[model samples]
Target: MSNANSDPLIVSHDLESISDVMRIVNREIWVVTAAAGNERGGLVATWVSAASIDDQTPTVLVGLAPNHYTTQLVEQSGSLTLHLLRESQLDVAWNFALGSGHDRDKLATLEYLLGATDAPRLRDCLAWLDCRVFARLVTGERHLYWVDVVAAARVHPGDALREHQLFASATPEQRQQLIANRDADITLQRPAAITWRKCLPEHLYFQPTQPTN
Candidate 1:
């Protein structure tokens, strides 16, 4: 039998090891929607987490790739709605993930209403959070937003869709497309990550100390 280390697909064995360790973490899929004036966009995202635990103040941290159209909308509007999809909402996930909002309107067919933050909230989600971006960090390939939860609701009673289930349920053609998209994104983002620069607001910026002999 051929050794696992000799696999042709293993671009970097070190990175592959990191990926293996990260797979143990639970990543729930979410649909993040944003609207800027007449423009609106949505995309499937997995990089969301609760940033604050204070009962009086709730916040969430979301990371979006800089290249996505939805990321542009979030930057323009400074607000977005994150939706937790039920297992039955795989179609919603496919719609947002498979197509680019730059090419066409992804929210055209989805039933939604404007939330308190002016972000488009999908009606069919298991739950939703309407958030306003209070702080942003530019991490080269990704834009990390710290958002205050302005409003939220639990709409339906169902198990939230997970990343593994979505992949298992995907058609063979869709699986191929998903893999292609993943590879394309990695190729596009790798360069940006390598040459990352710090860009922060005046209040958030600080000069790095120089090493001296």
Candidate 2:
């Protein structure tokens, strides 16, 4: 009899956790997601992963607690969208993160519109990808959502906006000046020698005379 676990398809992992990988991958773009269901929603998620596949479509993934409202909505809805936030949109990020629709409606959190499959996509996003959920993986109390990216397109040029959010274009002179000032301050603190020093030349100053006891 053939067995599922007998296959050599199981690959072992060398790393302890996917935290590092997730951080790097999330740095690609930050987005606010709002999915509609019995209770439509909005969430600021930086963590995403692939839980499974959906035929030819690439299954995108996002993890959330099973008991969270987001999970319930996603399971019932089976659809979502990724909105690439603009550079100056830190306000939106903070709002969605700290603010919730638990007591009231969170749909009015940002400027969003219905996309493929009724997924709410932000209007200020640089781009968005609408998806249909494929599968879910259970990792402790969290559920990893694997969804197929059914549709994708550029809504606006949010690359520069993202750059402005994370990295600032610092001038060469400014960087050099900053370094020099930092070094000078360090020197000043280094026993007044390594950081900086002040002394009178032997030829310009006379030695102190010893007190006669």
Candidate 3:
């Protein structure tokens, strides 16, 4: 017997249900910034998290897709800077995620400074952490790096952006445009895995239903 959830049609219809659950997961939005010599690149990401609790050894994990220019720079430089975005800094998030560093300099248009790790520290962020690559593992389609947090600073000390908030606030059209732009960037990376579909699968969506007789 085929599992109903595994059926393509059922899965398609359950997209909104999946999104409803995911939006409340409270993943903080971040910009993973890096520099390779003169080449500077950054990308909007939510896949960063602390990997260790050792006070003497601050560690973080940043998952970067192999196909992005930022990922290449991080590999070559062996370092990265993670920036926490403010809720108001949506433009900063879009700039890094939608634009291609291969065609133009992404950091040139933004205000930033060279950190101790030689990574680009985005000035518009609420806080930043400079990390040194301790080790790397090829995890699925992403290069998951175990980094030691060498330095950190609170730039603004204000409310940080959350992935769920971004989706909840954007209209359908705005969401669609953002997803389209992101897809274009992912195409450049040509990874075996694709990003999760951020848009609702169809115009009509259903809320979670309780048992009704």
Candidate 4:
């Protein structure tokens, strides 16, 4: 008889076993854009999924960290735009992922057009979906927004980038910085609404700690 423990994918029986498994999981990388009044921002996101199977009422869910300026914008405007990237758009992915919008406009240097919901639809991408938030649930340190698919279109025809691909291809320095940044972000419990971090590319990968002199 075959046993589950003999499965090649199975790790140890410890509760924390899946932490390493998640790193290799195939997830689609996406750019999430949003606007609130005059404020607009976007970020690279991997936690997105179809929330409904109904043909008449299509729905989707995106998880955004509350500390992000883009998350605040979506919370205020109740809308977001999810953009799919091509394999050739690695620069675009890093451009959005490695910055904050609090100090400057992250989209200022990019080409995009305002969609029906006033969210920016990136010009250089495989596809985009404009969504309107219907409800939000607090999940861990992130907020999962349930939204209706208001508009969608494929702007380009190409293979989309995947989360596993990025992690696998990242340079050693980049991977180490990402790990450090992620750990710093986890330790920070920023208030629900506040601009505590500056907008800069380096801020996305490394969070410097000041020494008490």
Candidate 5:
């Protein structure tokens, strides 16, 4: 019996569920935090859905479950911060996504600081935003944050953001370098395996060898 999910002939396209959609939407995204006011802790998130390039504030919104811990703090603070992940931040992005910082001192171990509005902005992030929450609109099971761009900081300039970045495809040069390094591996000091030529009929060869008695 074939599983219905893999049936491509099923004319109706069955898209991913909200959770499944989130798996794609929430990727190597970055947001470092330190002390949400008296909140005394930062909520790092990779599950953000950012869009709307034409808005006056150039809005980037994220949906959080109404019951999520960060949701309450964001609503109470009435503001939040967003950061653009840097090429060097592959580790930072993974740490927060894999673990929860709830009772732990997630900030003490990380390097960060308060932004213009006192929200946590990761020090290593390439770009930062101190946003003001204009509204907390409820969208089904999640509370959507509509933020106002109050302050902006760019740690790196001239970087392209026209498309989303992912780790699956490192730059071409990097991939080539990696493949070359792997093929030319020197871990084994012994010489590479010898390449043997194809064997032909002995009569076809004309070489003569002199044997010593």
Candidate 6:
């Protein structure tokens, strides 16, 4: 008899459940900024985490889409600054999230200063960290950078913006643009994910063994 869990239809349903669960998980919003010579770029991101526990040797893991202009700048400069926006800074998030830096200058209207890492550090953020990429892993659709935090500052004392808050605060036009951007990203990343999975060794994938009666 075939196991119910092994049914393809059930497996597909499980995947959908996983996606639904992910959608509800609250994550902090971050603005990752980078500059390479004359070119500067910034993008809204939610994938950043502490990589080291030691205060003396501060490090963070930042994930950026390989196709993003900010990611390209990080690659060229090996440096970036991460900004934690306040709850009232939805406009700042929208500015970076709504468009690509390759199409227009995202930082032209924003107030920022050159950080110690030489990345653009937005002045209006709740907090900011200047980091240098010491190592990186190029996953299929994302570039994971292990960065050393060289400088950090808490600019303003306020509630940090979260993903759910951002969504709730968006105007109708902003919400529509956000959905369009997400759909475009899904289109680009799906094939890349499949290609990456294909390249991985078959043995690396889990295969359930049949139980002996």
Best-fitting candidate, scored by TM-score:
6
Q: TM per model?
A: 0.85, 0.57, 0.75, 0.78, 0.56, 0.86
Candidate 1 lDDT at 16 equals 68
Say what the RMSD of model 6 is.
Answer: 4.2
lDDT for each residue of candidate 4 in 36-128, tens digit (9 for 90 to 100): 888899888998999898979999989998788999999889999999999877778877767588877888889999998989988889999
How are the candidates ranked when ordered by TM-score, highest leading?
Answer: 6, 1, 4, 3, 2, 5
Q: Which numbered prediction scores highest in lDDT against the true structure?
A: 6
Summarize candidate 5's per-residue lDDT along 1-213 as a digit string, tens digits.
Answer: 544543332323534454366456435455635345567445445546555677575676776544445567677777777777676565565454333456555556677777777777777777888877776655333467777777888888644221135435446764575455434432221122111112324654368798999
Q: Candidate 4: minimum summed lDDT over ten consecutive residues — where? A: 191-200
Candidate models: Cα lDDT each: 0.89, 0.58, 0.80, 0.81, 0.57, 0.90
- Lowest summed lDDT across 10 adjacent residues in model 5 is found at 189-198
Give the per-residue lDDT of model 6 (tens digit) for 61-90.
Answer: 999998889999999999999999999998
lDDT of 3 by residue, 64-104 (tens): 87777899999899999999988898777767766578987
Model 5 deviation from the true structure expressed as Cα RMSD, one decimal place: 23.7
Instruction: Give me the runs in candidate 4 sitting further than 4 Å from their true place.
Output: 1-16, 189-213
**How many residue pairs clash in model 3?**
1
Error of 5 at 211 (Å): 99
Off by over 4 Å in 6: 1-12, 201-213
Q: Which runs of model 1 end up more than 4 angstroms from their true locations? A: 1-13, 197-213
Q: Report the C-alpha displacement of residue 53, candidate 5, in angstroms.
A: 5.1
Q: Estimate, for each residue in 32-91, the C-alpha lDDT of model 1 and write its tens digit.
A: 999999999999999999998896999999999999999999999999999999989988
Which residue pairs collide in model 4, if any?
Answer: none
Q: How far is candidate 1 from the true structure (C-alpha RMSD, Å)?
A: 6.2
Pick by lDDT: 3 or 6, better one: 6
